[model samples]
Target: MTMIFGIPIQAFLGQLLVGLINGSFYAMLSLGLAIIFGLLRIINFAHGAQYMLGAFIGYLLLADLGIGYWPALVLVPLIVGLFGMAVERFALSRLYGVDQLYGLLFTFGLALVIEGVFRYYYGVSGQPYAPPPLLSGGTNLGFMFLPNYRGWVVVASLVVCFGTWALIERTRLGSYLRAATENPRLVQAFGVNVPLLLTLTYGLGSGLAGLAGILAAPVYQVSPLMGSDIIIVVFAVVVVGGMGSILGAIVTGYVLGLAEGLTKVFYPEASNIVVFVIMALVLLVRPAGLFGRDG
Candidate 1:
């Protein structure tokens, strides 16, 4: 058996694949964070809760209504987006003119409330969600066996990331979004509905989290506890990537995941700390992050 750096190639490749899968989740979650922070300028501490809500919603749809993965992928995001809008209207929106710390505090409290409510009803035990029949098998490539759903996740995440990047970077609506992020008052003078745009942007961010949750449902146990488990590492990923750039978030997620995978193969004990270590190094070298623009 061939080896890379004294580790068996098959083992290395398996870890690499696992890393990519984890990276997909990181990328999706961080993308949502980047969008919310960029446009709304609020640190959405409730993001993880919203992600959990997405998975739970998807699971309920599947169990109760017999809805499948494909439709839930589309509808769950919408449901979560609406939930985000309600949050903005009832809770977050009220804080728009206050100190930034107020927004952070509000969202943190909201996270606790959301998590506590779910815990009260469901307990912390996890539930399994089956992958759609179409994505249940694996293909044996000459190099390795690749599970179809895992492959689909990688491709879908890439497509969504790049598509979002293009939408924000190239389109006219995206142009307006960029302008609003830069100077909302100036954009408003040009006849754009900046507040509405802000609401929509937050909704979009929350919707992405929802989509990620739905995607993750089949892979991870659908539990109220899922978001709390991953959100910290994701925050570290956002810090490393630079919180403001969409493309940077995606790149950082994949790179960090690969790094973690390599660590798992060579030094199992260091794998968990690797991301935080990189985050520290990035903070020391570039406090604004790998792609952030200093304000």
Candidate 2:
């Protein structure tokens, strides 16, 4: 048997894979949170619920219309993005220019309402969504076995993360977006529709969460509690990464996920709480957050 740092390579690599998988979700979800907060200045408590909604939408599409995961992969996020856009246009837009707490509370209420509706209809049981046939099996990579679906998830998420980062950091539209956030009035005066941009930004963030949701559907149960279960951890990821730091969210998510996975292998007792412990430390050491700029 081979050993890696005194532990079986299989055990180490298995946990590492698990960490990477978890990190994928964390990175995508927290990226959305960071984007919304960074650009819109709204802390969206409904993000998790939106993620749940995305999964549900995909499940429903498959069940009702015989639409497969492939179709839902794109359709669900677009649907959820539109829903988020509607929310921003009609509801969330109203709360802008007020205390941020109001936005927070409003989103919290929105999440509750959405979750309650789903629970009332679907009950609390977990529903499984099958992965596509192409992603059905595992591969032997000499040192370890890797599930095709899980590997796809990690690769897909990395692509998405970097692609999003590029869109925001290296594009003309992104420059306008950052400029709008920094000076909405100036952008508006220059003939840019700042409100429209705000709505689109929220939509994009919600769309990212929705993408995470559908991606997660085959990996986890499609449950109403799904959002609530993982949301707190994601929020912690955002805080550790810095509230409005896009790159920070992506990096911190993957790193903390690896840390959590390794902890499970080495110290099972602390696996669940490891992320929180790190979060606490980061908070104490840098209240502005690891990637946050001090005001």
lDDT of 2 by residue, 131-227 (tens): 9999999999999999999999999999999999999999989999999999999999999999999999999999999999999999999999999
Collision pairs in model 2 = none
Clashes of each: 0, 0
- Highest lDDT scorer: 2
Stretches of candidate 2 exceeding 4 Å from the true structure:
none
TM-score between model 2 and native: 0.98
Q: Please estimate how well model 2 matches the true structure, expressed as its whole-model Cα lDDT.
A: 0.95
TM-score of each: 0.97, 0.98
